[model samples]
Target: MKFSYKAIDDVGTVVAGTLEAENREAVYLALAERGLLPTEVASGESFLRGYLQRLELALERIRPVDLIFFTKQFRTLFKAGIAVVEALRILEFQTQNGKLKRVVAQMGEEISAGGSLGDAFASHPSVFSPLYISMIRAGEASGSLAGVLERLVYIMDHEHRIKARINSAMQYPKIVVGALVAAFLFLLSFVVPAFASIFAGANLTLPLPTRMAMALHAILLQWWMVSLPLILLLLAGVYWYQQTPAGRLRRDRLFLALPIMGPVFCKAAMSRFASIFAILQMSGIGVLDSMRIISDSIGNSAISHEFDKIGDKLREGRGISDPLRSAKYFTPMVINMVAVGEESGRLEEMLQDISDHYDDEVEYEVGRMTELLGPLLIVALAAVVGFFALAIFMPMWDMVQTVG
Candidate 1:
């Protein structure tokens, strides 16, 4: 077979070329003999064509549930003493997701060709994060791949739960906002104009609020040509700002400073940091390295920036708790727990405890927000709608009273 290969030469320059080989193993050995580290090898034009075809097939077959099921199934199979290669082959055949099947097949082939499981996964960094890869590498070194996979499944499950909670919390607010927007547009575009015609025909002097509403209706009806474009442009500007790193950082910082929601955001960040740090430490990664990885995965640039400072302090031989306490983003309780963990040499356990504690705090805060927001939003919406209704209707009511 002909293979396309990527390798780094002795002098560290990356080279890509095609070579004839029996399989990927042959290509890897051929490169290794020449003091090149083979990064990847795929068989010929046929492989590339087939891979693309299979990718589409896989996307149609895979769902979030399917991915979750596969993770669980793989964990089960591995625990049942199945060989990693065989387990992957079984998963490949069983997976409905075309992409997942192809990935499983590639992983199986790579493992069979003497590549480490982590190395096989490293080929798909988008699907598998550096944290995942690091854990797997640590597991392999400690001869505990199965244990690592189990922990990974647990971590992913927890992450998914958090996502579900956030989605659920946002759903009602989004619906309410959308409904209010539609109602406002309907009033301005149709209802208010009907009232305006009545007042005009009756030749009555409208109240100040009623006159203002009629004027707004007229502007909306007549100048939408200008207004619509302006609205779109403003939206575009906001989107562009959010897409930039500085803008995102500014927005996240703003979110963390919000009155009711700011504490929730901070708690969420702290929970994530605690959880990921705990997992990395449990996986046998060093403190400094784990902190770096955890910081990268925290997802908020502001929080991540703070973590960079923490990592720097650790590198300079400062205690973890001291740096974190100095940062002032973390709560005193969290700092104290970390200090205890560091002193007792059980930082991982302490981090896990902190994560568990904060996870509850986040959930409670979200629930409180939901309870408070529902009534607040309803009252606010009612007030706005009532104001518009009174503004338009009071004039017509007075005109009727005068005629009667």
Candidate 2:
């Protein structure tokens, strides 16, 4: 349940914000924890308004760059001794994204209402991730919100650059594959049909490749009405399945097992895990809590599940490195470095090293994938063009010989 509450803070300024709680008592307790005196608490939102908010959130997408800029500017402002609410108000005005601006304004209002910074961020889960909220909560508790935002800006910027590099490497292959499909479709739809009609007029035996090409052309021309819907249904089913838990697990596993791209993804996930874990630890978050938070931050479900197991073992009083040895995705080097970090009392430094190591590895693997895939794509393209050429010209050569 959500409640809108009016409160008076230490200086007796009135503040108001919405909070999720089981009852008014919970709301009162939460406000008290924040050192606020609650005057009034009202429960629930109108169904239509709630529906509109949900729709708005679904439509509003916040990009990484937006978050990076927000955090960087926020850290600079807060470090300059501006009050949190004042800094947020500045951001609310300075933000370029209309949706982000609204979110910033709402956050400022929440803070003005005597809500904690973490709570304000939590209210917008689409804009703030679990890792972000947890770190902010830790920062609030430690009185290091500005520092935390600095680290967040760094992490978000690094992640964006990594993704950018990977996407740049993939752009060529994507364009090549798309072109191949377009050319093949055009050949089947127009060129092949014309040649197929000519072969039909000749009434001569066609080679197997020619026959296969002509059959594909026939399907494109005659069966498209039936085929289009089935193709769409198959794609939709695939998307739905991938969204399911078991299907996501299998799909992520398959991603890690892929030949050229697997190591890039694996290294990227490891880099993210180490980076987030290090920052969370540095921010005064406990090891177990960091593990739980990092698990959700990792993009791969298979790796995330392993982190869950590691968290379970941490609950059993085992150290982080020991259980990591048993995880399939944790490289031997990572396990050894973690073990050393545990013994040396330099876990944060070690985690940073691990993150840096994997960051380099991800870069190298992406470059290697580009190199390997370039030749492979060329070979595949050659084979496709050669096959189509043979399929079309073989019949022409045969006709020429017959006429001679």
lDDT of each residue in 271-387, candidate 2, tens digit only: 898888889888999999888888888878999999999999899999889899888888998889888988999888998999999989998999899999988888877777777
Q: Give me the displacement of residue 347 in model 2, in angstroms.
A: 0.7
Model 2 lDDT, full chain set: 0.88
The C-alpha RMSD in Å for every predicted model, in order, reads 10.5, 11.9
Per-residue accuracy of model 1 over 1-404 as CA lDDT, tens digit each: 89988899989899998889888888888898989998878887876887788776755644556666778888899999998899999999998776777788998999999998889988977666677778888888898878888888877777767667766877777787777778877877788887777888887877887887788888987899999999999999999999998988898898888887788889888888888888877777888888778776787778887888889999998988999987847899999999999999988899999989988988998888788777877887786688688977788688879889
Evaluated at residue 332, the lDDT of candidate 2 is 90
Show where candidate 1 strays beyond 4 Å.
1-67
Give the C-alpha miss distance for residue 261 in model 2, angstroms: 0.5
